[model samples]
Each structure stands twice: as structure tokens, then as C-alpha cells.
Target: MIRDKIRELLKKNAEAETNFSLEKPERAEFGDYAANLALVLAKERKENPRKIAEDLIGKIKGNREADIFEKIEIAGPGFINFFLNKDAVLEEFKKLSKLKTLLKFKTPKSKIQIEFISVNPTGELHIGHGRGAFYGEALSQVLKLTDYKVEKEYFINDSKESSQIKELGKTVLDEGTSYLTENLKSQISKLKTKIKNLKLEKPKNLYGEAGYLIAEEIQKDNKKFIEKELGIKFNNWISEEKNLRQKNYFNKILEILKNKNLVYKKQGAFWLKTSQFGDDEDRVIVRTSGEPTYFLSDIAYHFQKIERGYKKIIEIWGADHQGHQKRLFAVKKALDWQVDMEILISQVVTIKKGEEIKKMSKRKGEVILLKDLLAEVGKDAARWFYLQKSLDTHMEFDIELAKKREEKNPVYYVQYGHARMASILRKAKSGKISPPATFTFAEDAEILLIKKILEVFDVLEDAIKDYQVHRILSYIYELVYVFSVFYRDIRVLDSKQERERLFLVKETKKILANLLRLIGVAAPERM
Candidate 1:
């Protein structure tokens, strides 16, 4: 938001148009924000950078935009550093006294659908799915907090035509595959009675029927575990077989591709001309035996998102799906539709137990179930550890550090900071300690903490723009570190300025709680 203000000031003041950058300086003496507008202009005009910086400052002062910053100084050959007015920054940030009012960005509301953790119904969720699962849920919460209409969705690959589902069916029939586990055996046992009740043909439709039914049972258990244990609730559970294929939606899309001459017969199979639209090569839409490929179903699925009125569709996939972006873009090009599509591939995760990790296997075999991790480290720690890392990087989950109750643990450290603030307010029960009539922060610790707190707006803006949820964790760590320094340096109970300091603690708690909620962790009053 402050960047927008500087952008407007530069637009009205400068003679040339250049894409400038405004970044927060790592050191406070360099000022609150540093801009490279002068250097960018110097490159174009072939003039001295410091002279350009001085001219821009003069124009900014003339335009009366100097009120936005306390001082504008030129540093190191053209970097424009802006130190914000302390009182003005405090007025804006102190309004974050409630969790609901943090940032309050009035972005235009558009419908967004985020599909994540679409693990096939063939097996229980594993550690690999946990990354996208938690990332999607936390990102959805963050979008909703920023006033976007967001929905969480899961795509179930339950079609009997699917190779994975057919493999699951093979396990059910014990016909060469030994993937049967306790859960599959239980589902197969129930499938026998259901098949007997239907009185279907002996062997013709038996394999597909058995596989389809067992997958449905497994999906129900996965849904329960996700909602009950992992605290994730999807708004929609889209079925590949029932929702699309059963309704002939897949055939409809195939016909559209064929009618446009986008599909051709090659080697006895129908292939899409994705190479014309930027794929590495043409991809098969139908097998040689006339079965639809999974790529065809995915094309149909993305079309369905647009048909259902979602302007923006984001998919969180696993690392295994890398190099899959090209074909999806080709699909968009072939359809000739302008839509905002984002696909994030979350990397794998490793677990460290420090000699006490209890890793239980799922139905298919031992692959490290997500529920076991949640059971061992707990929901809050699991969420914090997963969300603290960037989605594109591999991560390790250390169970020993996650379960630590002291300040060495990151989640514990943030929560304990909030709890300590609450303790101060509890002891200073001066009947709703509100700020005095003329309140001004005069201490160095107070000024530093307030400046750090004001960056919450910039953090949220960046998260919304880039979909980088890890920024929230990084911001919280810095905010709390400065607050800890402020807490140690200032007196809050029975001091002459008890009311103003208590008010600061209360507002800081709101900001901390709101940020923790974005990561789906709790900010406790007492540890």
C-alpha cells in the first residue's frame, strides 16, 4: 500500500516513466524504504544518479507529497531512501487493534477455486500430500482474510477407467497384485455383499465394479481423516467418474476438440495437436483401444472450472507433477479462453523423530501416514512447520524440535510472546487500559516496534500478489522479535505510562493472533 503511494508520487512528479522498485532496507539507518527510481532514470538519460535523485526529491516536495515521509535522502549513487513520519505510521498501524481490521485491503472480489491434495482414492494420504494439503488450506484462509471469495476443492480420481483405480481393482480381486491391506480387505468384504445384492454378471463387469466400490469406501475414510484430524474441509469433492464421465462431459469436450481439427488419428489412437500450442509433443487423447487418457479428463476438468464461473483457478500439485505445466497451457491456448490459472508444485518432506517418532503405515503399505505425524507432533506444530517453508523447496520435519515446549521451538516462541503480553495486561487490571488523550511513543524501543508492526500491510499485499504464504511466518518472526525487545525495555504495570503501553500490548496481540490464524496455528494466552 505504501508502494502505491510512492508510485503515485513519482508518476505526478517525474518527466520520464520507468518501472521503479521500492524495498525495505535491511538496516534502519538506511530508512524505512529504499527506492531505485533515480538509478533507473540515470540509465535511460545517461546523467548523474545523485542529480536525478535530488531533482526528484525537489519535485516530490513541491507536489506536497513530502508528508508521506519524514525525510528523503539519496544514498550510494542513486538509491532514494524514505524514512516515514513516526506519528503518521503509528496512526495507521495502531488501528490494527482487532484481528478483523488488519490490512482491510479492498481488492475487487472474484471467485477463486483452489484444488489441492487430489490423491487418488486408492490409498490413504501420505507425507507427500501433507505439503499441498496444508498449503492450500492456509492459503485459502489467507485469501478469505484479505476479502477474496475462495473455495477449497479436491478432485477424486475414482473412475474405473483410470489405471490407478484398475490397479486398485486388481488388488481387490487378488489377481496378480498383492497391494491388499487391512482397509482394502475390509472394503472388499463389504463389496461382496453389495455385489451379491446387485446380482450382476459373473466376470464381465466384476473387476471395474469391485474397484469402483472399494475406491468409494476408501475416499469416504480419507475425507473423514482430512476433516476430523487434519482440520481441512473442502467445499467441493468433485468426482471424475460420477460428475464428469457419467454425465458425458468428457465426450462433449472430446467432440469439441475434434470439431476444431485440434485432434488427429495417429498410430490407431487419437492425439491432440498440443505441439502447435507449445507442448513438447502431441499428446494422446484416447488410447489405441478407444479408452480416454487421463490428460483428456484433466482438460475436461479445467474446462469445468471455467464453466462453473471460477475466474481464477489455482491447483496445488506434488513434486511428481513437475514438467506438466506445458500441456495445461496448451489446453488453455486451444480453448482460446482468458483465465487466470496457477499451478504450484509442492516438493516432498522428510521426517526426523530423534528416536521417538512413531510412524505408522497406511493401508497400501508403510509410506508414512499424515495422521501419524499429526498424532505425534500435533496440529499446531504440524501446521507451523509445514507452512514455514517455501512450497517449491524440499523440507524436513524434525519431531523433536516441533514438540519442544520452550522458546527454542518457533511456534512455542510466538505463542509464548503473545501469552506474556496477556500476562502483563492481566496483572495491570486498571479497568480497560485505554490510551491517554495525547499519546506519543518517545522511546527508541517503542519506535522500532511500531515501525516493524506497520509492515504487516506490505506483507499481506505481497502474499496476495505472489501466493507466497511463507511470508506471513517470516513477518511474524520479525514482528515478535522487536516486540520482545520492547517488552523487556519498557514497564507496563504500575508505571506512569501504564495505559499507553498496555494499549500497545493489546494491539500487538491482535496482530499476532491474526497472523497465527492465517497459518492455522493458535495464539494462546498462557502456555
Candidate 2:
């Protein structure tokens, strides 16, 4: 809101239209906020940047906008730095009572559908899949809090694959016939654990029946683990096989492409003209064997999403699908769809022990499964570690660091800050002392802490726009770091201004709790 007010003031005085950047100055002497409007305007208008900054300052000073800033100065080449008035900062803090309402004004509400963790119902979800799961859920939470109508979806790929079917058949047969090799025993044990209702009797169509049963068991287990262990609940579970069975759905997609002149028969296969829309080569939608390819099914699935009338569709995918993004976008272009679509690719996650990096391969049966990771550290620690980094950056999960219970662990450090604040609030409640109307923060640490707290709404607003939920982690770490300093240097319960300090502590606790909830982590009241 403060940034908006400053932008409004700058826009009224500028000679030409330009996109300006307002950010916190890196140095304390620069000011609370800095704008690079003069630099931008200078490049466009061919004027001295410092002169442009001076002129902007003159116009702002002439208006006598005392409530916004106490001082405005030109710094560096063209940067305009503004020191916010202390009273204005205090007024912003007072609005914390209506914080939720304040956040709603930051973004336009829209109906959005986000699909993530749509792994095939063939095997257990490994730690790689956990990254997308954590990222998607956190993004969904932020969107919901920011007033978007969000539909969290998991697309189940239950269509039959011949190789997978045979594998399932062998496993089931091995278990049923009691030829229990170590690997077969392990597979049967895991299957039984995941699918409590599994009845592995020998059927006439061995592979077909076995595949169906395996997929059913996987879908059930995946849903339970996601909802109960990971604390994520999807609004919709869209089954690909079910959608494929819908009357003429696949046919409708082919017809749409044909009408657009985007399909062709080449080498005894039906190909989509993906190269015309920017793909490296044309892609086959239907193979020479007369069976539709996975690409065709994906196109139909997106068409179904479009028909559902969502304004935006977001897909969280793994890095392995990086090359598929262009083909998917080409399909959207071929269909001339109006809905906005975004594909976010989460990079690989490597788990590390003390000195050795653990390599994982589900096919090789040498992998850290999601359930195992959850069991090792916990849902809270796992989610926090996965969500703390950018989705596009490859991350290494340090098992040792995650297991630590002290300040060295970021999750523990943040939770400890909340627990400490909760303790302070509990003490204040027991004393039955109301916070003072007139407050004075004599300590510099208290002022810094308030500044950090006031910046959270802006940080969250940026996170929503950029879809970089990692920013929330950075903000929490900084907020808690400031709080740690304040807690160490300033006395709250036994201070001369106990009630006012307690008020600050209470506000900090609320923010910590809200942030933890956004990332799907628990903010424990006690360490």
C-alpha cells in the first residue's frame, strides 16, 4: 500500500510513462524505500538522471506529503530514496487488526485451477515427487489467502501400459505362488501395507486384472498419504482413464486440430504440426499401430480443463518434463485457447548423508520414497526443507541438518521463535495487563523488528505474483532473526513498558503462525 501511494505520486509528476521499481535500500543511510524511476525516465527521455531525480523531489516536496515520508533525497546517479515517517509506520502497524482485509486489496481475485503431483498410479512416490507436492500445496495456500478461487487437483494416470501391467502380474504371481525372493517379498509387503483391502487371488486375465488391482491400490494409498501425512487435500481427483472413456472426448480433440489444419498423416501415423507452433519437430498423436499416444490423451485432458471454465490453469511438473512444455504450449496455440496456462518445472532433489550423496532410482529399487522421508524427519521438516528453495534450482536435502533440533535447523529456529513469543503472550495473559495505547520503542532492535513485520504483506503479494513461494521462507528467516535479536537485547515481560512489548510479541506470533500455515508447516506453541 505504501509502495502504491509512492507510485501514484511519481506517476502524476513524471513526463512520460515508465515502469518504476521500488525496493528496500540495501544500506540504512539510503532510506527505508528507494525508487529507480529517474534512471528509467532518463534512459527514455535523454535527460540527466540526477536532474530528473531532483525535479521529482521538488514536485513531491511542493505537495507537502508529510504523512508518507519525513525526508526524500537523491542518491547515487538517479536513485530517489525515501525515509518513511515514524508516525506513518506506526499507523501501518495499527492496521494489523485488519491484516486479512488489507491483504485482499493487493491482488485481483480469479478462479484458478492448479494441478500437481499427478504421478502415474504404478509405484510409490519418491522424494523427487515430494518437491512438486510441497511447492504446489504452498502455492495453493498463498493463492487462497490472497483471495483467489483455487481448485487444487491431482490428475491420476490410470491408463494401462503393457510393460507396467506385466510387472504387476509377475509381482502378484510371485506373492500368490509363495516364490518369495527378497525383492518380491519386499514388493508384496509394501503393497499389502499400502492397500489394506488388496486381495491378490489368481485371476483368468492375470496381467490385466493384476494391473487394475495395482493401480487401484496405488491411487488409494497416494490419496491417503497426501491427505493424512502431508496435510494436503485436493479439491478434485481427475482420472485420466475416466476422462478417456467419456463420449467422443478424444475424437473431439482430433477434430478440433483437424479443423485448424494442424494435423497430418505421416509415415502411417497421425502427426500434429507442432513444429509450426515452435516445437523442434512434429509430434505423433496417433501411432502407426492405430493406438492413440500419450500426447493425444494429454491434449484431451487440457481440453477438458478448458471446458470447465477456469480463467487460469497451472501445472506443477518435474524437471524431466522440461522438454514437454513447448509441445504442450504448441497444442494450446493450435486450439486457439483463451485461458492462461502456466507450467512450472521443479528441478531434481538430491538427498545427502554426511559426505556421500545418495542416488535414487525407483526402477532400481534404490530410492528414498516419500513415505520413508516423512518417517525419517517428519512432514513439517520435509515440507520446510523442500519449500525453502526455488523450484527451478536443484537442491540437496541434508539429512543431518534436517534432523537437528537446534538453531542450526531453519525450521526449528523459526518454530522456536514462535514458541518463545507464545510463551511471552501466555505470561502477559496471566498478568492480566492490557497493552498501552501510547507506545514507545526506545530500543533500535524493536524498531527493526517492527519494520520486518510490516514488510510481510508486501513480500506475500510479490510471492503470489512471481509464484516463487521460496520468498516466504526468506522473509520468515529474516523476521525470526530480527525477533531473536530483540528477544535477546530487550526485556518484554519484566520491562518498564511490558504491555507495549507484549503487544509487539503478540503481533510477531501471528505473522509466524500465518507464514508457517502458508507453507503447510505447523507453528508449534512450544519447542
Candidate 3:
């Protein structure tokens, strides 16, 4: 609201005709805030910036528009900086105190289905898979926290893909396929024929794991290793094989698109006229081989989601799927649906041992399973490490850093800060210590910690809207570092201000616990 008022005043002034940007001053020696509007205006008007800044400062002295700023100054290169009363900074703490009883953001009031990490049922999850699992799960948590109607979905790609088709064909033929042996193939064929002929309940791969038996066996220990390491879970596991084949849904969707003339047969295969809807090129829905492309069944699955009544569909995909976004949007446009879709692209992860990079592959034995990372550094450490960097940036999983498991570890640092707060609280409870009636800031360290801690709410909202989970991670790590330094420099318990310390410690724990829970990290009592 305050920011809006500033923008309005800047827009009203004809001479100060540029956009206003409020920034904190470089140092305490200067004003607490700065704006570079004069510099922008000078460039536009072709005048000296300093003279323009001076004119604005003089005008601002009596202007009610500048009331939000306690002090404003013209800094180097015609920058206007403002300093507000300390109460402005303290206001955040008051908000934090009330956070226990209040909600900050309004609800979207629409159900959201986010499908992610639907890694094929073919292999164990790797570090790359962990990125999607963490980001998607964290994004879901943030939305829920902000009061969005959200559901987590895992689209199990068990059918129609090259990988799945190969696996299924191999399984049906029983040509050394993993789970579908000769006996299993015969059983499945008999069941398939039975389903076609009988009106009774048809048998199926009720044991989905049975299909992945061979792949799992080859990477048996590695699969367990990855799961234990990543903490990945799905609320809904929708099997494409089951969903695509459900009453011939794929054909049913194609029929609808065909009737709409949104689909066309070209080059001996069916193609979706995605280019008509601004896609780079028309996408093939069915290959010349008579097999439906993954996009064809994807349309069916998306239609299934729409049928389920989700107004919003969010997908978390790896960077490699960047080009896949246009086609998905094309489906939405072709169907004439108002459903909103947001796809977050998670960058790749690199495994490093000491200083050497260790390449990982799911097919090759060279893969470093998620479980391996967990075994080496524990879950909290691994997650913190994985999420510490922005999803848009490639993450290097440093084995040496994780192996240290020291206070230097990003996760351990945050947990230790939380643990330290817990320790302070325990001391207060044990000693029955209390402070003055009125809450007040004392030491510089105490104020610094409070300031940093209060920013989590803002960061949470920012990450949710921008789809930037890494910002939350960065904020938490910074908060922890600040708190740790403050904790070391100042005594929190057994002092005249012990009650206030107890309050801060309690609030700190609340934030740490909530944030850690959201990011799939553990805020341990002791570390």
C-alpha cells in the first residue's frame, strides 16, 4: 500500500516524469533509502541529473507525498533515497507476533492439480528426479500455505512412450523381460483376451511393481538407496496404461479433436495443428508406425484431469522438456478450456566427488541413486543441498561438502540455528526465567535476528508467485546464518531479558519448523 502511494505521486509530477524506484542506501552514512527517478528523468529530458534531483528534493520537503519517508536525500548520480522511522522496520515483528492468529494472503478458491516427478516406473529415481520431487512438493506446500486448493499428482508414464512400449512389448513377448516372464506373459495374454470376451472382472497388472521387477532387480539396491535418500512420495499415482486404455479414452479424445477439425492427417500420420495456436510447428499425435505419440495420450490424460474438475493444472518438468510446454498449451487452446497451466522447469544436477564430476545415468550402473546421497549426508543435508540453488540454475552435488556433515553444511547450519533456539527455550523453561512486561529490542544481534526471521513470510509469497523455490532456500539459509551469529554473540537465556528471548526463540522455532516441513527438511531438536 505504501509503495502504491509512492508510485502515484511520481506519476502525477510532470517534471519528475520517470518511474520511481525506492532502494536502501548503500551505508548508514547516507540516507536509509534512495530512488533513481531523477537520473531516469534527466535522461529523458536531456538535462543535468543532479540539478533535477535537487529540484525534486526541495519540492519533496513540504510534499505530503513524501510522508512515508522520514528522511530523503539526493545521492550520487542524482539518486533520491529515503529513510523511514525505525518503527517501519519494527512493524514486521508486530506482524510476526500476530501471524499465529492471522492469515496474510487470500485464497485462490480453485482446485489445483500439480503432477510432477511422474518418472517412468522403469527405473529408480536419480538426483535429477529428486529436483522435480522437491520443487513440485515445495511449490504445492507453498500454495497450500497461501490458501490455494491444491492436490499432488504423480502421472505414472507406464504406457505409450518409447520406453514403456518397448518394455511392454518385451514383457508381452517374454523375451527376457524383467517382471513379465513366460508364465506372466501367458497370464497377461489370457487376461487380455478374457477382458475382450467376458463381461466379468478382467485381470490386470494389479501388481504394477511386477512390471518393473526386472529393472528393479538389476538396480535393486540402488532403488532402495534413492527412495531412502530423496523422500519422494505421490498423493495420486495415475497409471497411463490404465488411464489411456480406460474405455479407449485415447481414441475418444482423437475423435473429439477430429470432429473439431483441430487434428489433421499428414505425412501418413495424424498431427495436431499446434502451429495454428502459436506453437513452433504442428506436433505429431500419431507416428507413421500406427502408434500414438506420447503427446496424443498426454491430451487424453489432460482431458481426464479436466473431467476430474481441476480448474488449474501445474506441471514441474525437467529442463529437457522445455520444448514440450508449447504442445501442452496447444492442447488447452484446442479444447477451448479456461484451465490455467504453469510448468516449472527444473535445471539439471551434477554429482561431484571431491573435485571430480561423477556422471549419473539411470540406465547405466554409473548412476548415483538418491539413496546414496542420503546415506552419505543424511536426508536433511541432501535436501538442503539440492534445494539451496535456484531451480533455473544447474546444481552441483558436492560429495565432499556433504561428507563433511559439519556446521558448514547448508542444512546443518539452518538446523543448528533452530537447535540453538530450542536449547535457549529449554533453558528458559528449566530456569523459570521471565523478563519485563513490555516487548522491546535490546542488543544489536537480537534485532538483527528478529529482522531476518520476520522476512520468511514475504519470501514465501514471492517464491509461490514467481515459482522460485530456491529464493525461500536462500532466505532461510541467510536467516540461519544471521541467527547463528547473533546466538553466538549474545546470551539468550538466564538474563534480565530472558522472557523476551523466550518469545523470540519460540517464534523462531515456529518459523523454522514450518519452513523445514515445507521444504522436506527436518528441524532437529539437536544436531
Candidate 4:
């Protein structure tokens, strides 16, 4: 909102179209906000940048009468720096008492569907899947907090023809009917122990029977480990098997593709003209063996999503499926759907303990389970570590660091700041201290903490626009660090400034709690 107000003023004062950049100045002396509009307009209009900045400042001063800004200055060739009035800043701090009502952000009235961690129901969820689950859950919370109608979904890849499911069946049959490899032997032993009635004899349709058993086990594990342990609840659990069984669903999709001239039969196989829609090559929807490929089912699933009337659909996919993105987009183009669809690819998670990199392979039964990881650290630490990094980049999750109870751990540090603030408030309340009608911020640390506290709203807005949830981590970390400095340098209990300091501590705690909750991490009152 602050950035928007500044942009409006810049646009109104500019004579021509200009693309400018606005951001907080790195140094405190530079000002609270900085804009490069004069530099951009001067480059476009061939005018002196300093002169343009002066002219823009004049217009801003003439148009704005409110005491929102304390000072506006030009510096360093063309940049315009703005300082907010201290009264305005304090007013924002006061509003934090009713933050939810005061910061009622306006968002578009549209339904959005977010599908994430939709792994095939063939095995237990690994650490990589945990990353996706945490990221998706945190993103959903962020969107909801910003006033968006959000639907979180888990798309189960459990079709009968799935290659993974078929492999699982083969594994089960091999273990049941013959000697099992060391890799799969343990899993089959566990499965047999769990399902007492599981027959050791090979069935007539081993693939179907074994696949069903494994899929059922996977679903059960997902409910217990993923949903319950990790606290991620899905609004929809879409089953590919169910969708595939829907009468005429696949056939209807084929017909739609045929009507659009997007599919053709050749060499006893059906192909979609994906290359025409920016894909590298045409992709097969149906094989020569008379079985539909997984791609066809995926297209149908997306169609179902659109049919449900979502204005936007966001798919959080693993980086391994990056190549499939274009083909899916081609399917959307073939259907001529007007809805917005985005595929957010999450990179791999590399787990490490000290200097040793832990190898993870699900098929080999050599992977860190999500439940095990949650047990090792905690839900809050796991979620924080998983989400504190960018989704598009590889993350190295250090087990030892995550388990630490010191400042080296970011989650602990942030949560400690919150706990520390809560202690301060309790002390103030016990002492019957009340905030003064007016206050003065004399200490540099005090002013710095207030400035950092005021920045959460801007950070939240930027995260919503860019879908970069990691930025919130950076903001809260800095806020906590500043608060730590304030606590160490300034006294709070039994001082003349005790009440005023308590107010700042309370506001800081609110922001820290909000940010932690947004990331689905707990904000403990005591550590």
C-alpha cells in the first residue's frame, strides 16, 4: 500500500510513460524509501536527471497536503528518497493492536486452485516430498492471509496404468512368489506383517491386486504421516484412478482433442500435436498397445480442474517433471481454455548430516522418511528449514543445524525473539506498567526495530506479487536481530521507558507470530 501510494504520486507527476524502480534505501541516512523515476524519465526524455527530480519533488509537494511524509530529498544523480513522518510511523505501530481489522487487504474475487505434493501412491513420502508439502502449505496460508479464496489440493497419481504402480506390483509379486531382492525385501515383509490376509501365492492378475494393495497402503501412510504428522490438510484429494474410472471421461477428452484437430492416429498410436504449441515434439496420448499414456490422464485432470470453475490453477511440481510442462501447456492451448495455469517447479532437496551427504532412493528403500525427519527435528523446524529457501533452487537441508537449539538455527532464533517479547510483556503486566499517551524513541536500536516492524506489510505484499515466500524469512530474521539489539542495549523492566518499550515489544511479537503462522511454523510463547 505504501509503495502503491508512492507509485501513484510518481505517475501523476511524470509527463510521459516511465518505468521506475522503488525500494527501501540500504542506509538509514538515505531515507526510508527511494525511487528512480527521475533517472528513468530523464533517460527516456533526454533531460537532466537532477532537474527532473527537482521538478517531480515540486509536484509531489504541491499535490500532497497530508503529514504522511516528513521529508523528500534528491540525491546521487537522480534518486528520490522519502522519509515518513514519525507521527505516521507511530500511528502504524498503534494500529498493530488491531492489525487484522486495520490491514484488511483487498484482493480479487476469484477462485484459485493449488495442487502440490501429488506423488504417486506407490511408496512412503520421502524428504523431497516433505519440501513440496511444506512449501505448498505455507504458500496457501500466505495467499489466504492476503485475502484470496484458495483451495489446496493433492492430485493422487494412482491410475491403473501408472508405470510406478505397475513397478510396485511387480515388486510385490516378486517378493511374494519368489526370492526378493534386499532392496524390496524389507518393505514386503512389513506389508505382509500389516496385512495378515495377504496371500503369498501369485494371483491371476498380480498387477491389479498388488497395485491395489500398495496404493491402499500408500494412501493410509499419507493420511497418518503426511496429513497428521505435518499438519497439512488438503481441500481436495483428486484420485487419478477415480477420474480414469469415470465413464467416458477419457473418451470425451479424446473427442475434444480430435474435434480441435490436435490429435491424430499414426502407427497404431494416437499423438497430440504438441510441437505446434511450442513443445519440442508431438506427444503420445495413446500407445500402440491400446493403453492411454499418463499424459492423457493428466490433461483430463486439468480439464476437470477447469470444469470446477477455478479462475486460476497452480501446480507445484517437482523439478524432475520440468520437461513435461510444455506438453501440458499444449493441452491447455488445444482446449482453448481461458483460465490461468501455472506450474511451479520445486528443485531437489539434498539432505546432509555434517559433511556426509545422505543418499535417498525410494525404490531401494534407502530414503529419509518424512515422519523420521519430523521426529528428528520438529514440525516447526522442518517446515521453516524447508520453506526458508527459494523453490526454484536446490536446498541442502542440514540435519545437525536444524536440530540445534542456538542462534545458529534460524527458526529457534526467530521463535526465541517471540518468546523473549512475551516474557517482557508478562513482566510489564505484573508490574502494572501502562504505556504513556505520547512517547519518544531516543535509542537508535529502538528506532531501527520500529522501522523493521513496519516493513512486514511491504514484505508480505511483495511476496504475494512475486510468489517468493522466502522473503518473509529474511524480513523476520532481520526484525528479530534488531529486536535482540534493542533488548541488549535498552532497558525495559522498572525503567521510566518501560511502558513505551513494552508497546514496541508487543507489536514486534505480533509481527513475528503472524510471519511464523504464515509459514505454518509455530510461534511459541516460551522456548
**Among these predicted structures, which one has the highest TM-score?**
1
Per-residue C-alpha lDDT of model 4 across residues 231-330, encoded as one tens digit per residue: 9899988877776535556788888899888888999999999999888999999999877788988888888888889988888998789999999988
lDDT of 1 by residue, 1-527 (tens): 56678777876777777788888899989998888988998899999999989999998988755786888899999998988887767766555543455566666688889999999888778887888999999888878865568999999988778877778777776673645667677777877877565345566556666678788889999999999988899999999999998988789999999999999998999999999999999999899978889899999888888999988889998877888889989989988967889999998788877855444344546688788788888999899899999999988888899999988898888989888888888898688866566557889898888778778888888788788999899899888889999988988788888888888887788788888877889889987
In lDDT terms, which candidate is top? Answer: 1
Off by over 4 Å in 4: 15-19, 100-102, 175-206, 359-366, 429-436
**Would you estimate the TM-scores of all the predictions?**
0.94, 0.91, 0.80, 0.92
**Candidate 3: 10-residue stretch with minimal lDDT:** 198-207
After aligning candidate 1 to the native by TM-score, how far in Å is the CA of 440 from where it should be?
A: 2.0
Better of 3 and 4 by lDDT: 4
lDDT of candidate 2 vs native?
A: 0.81
The sequence of per-residue lDDT tens digits that candidate 3 reaches over residues 309-398 is 898888889877898988889778878877888888888798888779976654454666665576777777777777778888888988
Alpha-carbon local distance difference test for all models: 0.84, 0.81, 0.70, 0.81
Ranking by TM-score: 1, 4, 2, 3
- Residue-level lDDT of model 2, residues 36-72, one tens digit each, is 9999999988999999999999888766554578899
In candidate 2, list every pair of residues with a backbone clash: none
State candidate 3's TM-score: 0.80
Locate the minimum summed-lDDT window of 10 residues in model 2: 175-184
Model 4 residue 200 lDDT?
49
- Models sorted by lDDT, best on top: 1, 2, 4, 3
